[model samples]
Target: MAIKFTPIPTTTAESWRNGGTDAHGQKPERRISDGRAPCRHCLKNVPEGDAVLLGAYKPFDAAGAFTETGPIFICEKPCKRFQGGTNEVPPVIAQRDQFLIRGYSADEKIDYRTGQIAKVSDLVSQAEKIFALEDVSFIHVRSAAYSCFTTRIDRAR
Candidate 1:
């Protein structure tokens, strides 16, 4: 199976940049990047000294007990959304040490059996394995240390 690393939609990111409220109904907090945080839309590190928008984002469209809302960083300036071949891991995320990988069903509910803390080196293979499961419709990569949202993965067409 070919899996693609998917970033949040550009429209959603644009909304935030245009003074939209976050998931908690609050404005996105602007902060200076330390060069370690990746903008969820571009899947690249927000450069040091660049302004970042910190806010809560729910990666799913569904509202349910298993749906999670978590923190994410977005570049305050315009950035092209990440575009890569199927099964290619974004460079910024690939440089990370580890991340929490979990599969979600079609309904957007977490499938606990697919949860694991995976090394960056194993992300592609691990995601492929999870995609092999029948119930898994997608996967979400999150910071293992902070539990913040990173990126979403889906079986490529």
Candidate 2:
């Protein structure tokens, strides 16, 4: 299976940024970057001087215990969506020493044995190894240090 790195969709991000609501359907919590969070839309760190939104987000559309709503960062203003090459590690992942990668089943439940902390440099191959399995439906890349949702990786159609 060919892998594709997917960032948060721009439309959803725009709705949240424009104050439609967060995943919780409440106004998104806004804050200034302290240098740790990255805007999932752009797949880039929210530079120290910029504004950002801190809000709960569910990576999967499925609504169950496995559907987690965790804190995620987004630009206070709109930015271009990440368009990194397929199977390539985005700058957000590549700039870090390591990040967490984990697989999920078709039902969106976590696949226990597929979770691993991957070196940024080796991320693509690591993802390929996991996707090689028939049971794996999709994978998520998260900030290893804090385990926040970064993006999803899916097999290219």
Candidate 3:
């Protein structure tokens, strides 16, 4: 029943850093972090006054109705990707009091029944319950307030 909390792939982040366009097909906006912005690649909050790349990111490979593109932040400079204990929530995500959790099927369709807003402490347990369902293939952790993409969670093999 192990679960892996994953950051955005480094290759993708590097692409963005190397002048790649966002989901909107436009250059990513560079901004100064307000400390609340978390880098999706590093799974850590970008400190206040530091540079960040704000852009639209589509987390799925498929292009369909179920596929969603949303705003995300990443460090303007390179940072180490997150490597942490399986089944533990990333600190950047846990820093928030609550988050939206949803499950997606193997075909990349949303499983409406698996969506909920969970307290940080309850996140792991809730994700476990979602993973219990046969239809659920992966989970997305999102900001409860802004509904921005935070990180992804996958059932460990």
Q: What TM-score goes with each of the models? A: 0.97, 0.93, 0.97
lDDT of 3 by residue, 62-137 (tens): 8999888999999999999998788877879778899999999999999999999999999889999999999999
Ten-residue region with minimum lDDT total, candidate 3: 87-96
For candidate 1, the clash count comes to 0
Candidate 3 lDDT (Cα, 0 to 1)? 0.92
Pick out the ten consecutive residues of candidate 1 with the lowest summed lDDT.
Answer: 86-95
**Backbone clashes in each candidate structure, one number apiece?**
0, 0, 0
User: Which residue pairs overlap in candidate 3's backbone?
Assistant: none
The residue ranges of model 2 lying beyond 4 angstroms of the native Cα positions read none
Against the hidden true structure, what lDDT does model 1 obtain? 0.92
Clash pairs (backbone) in predicted model 1 = none
Cα TM-score of candidate 1: 0.97
Q: List the RMSD of every prediction in angstroms.
A: 0.8, 1.4, 0.8
The residue-by-residue lDDT of candidate 2 on 3-73, one tens digit each, is 78899999889999777787888888889897767889898888897899888888897799878778888
lDDT of 1 by residue, 1-157 (tens): 7889999999989999999999999999999999987999999999999999999999999899988899999999999999989888897798789999999999998888899999999999999999889999999999999888899999999
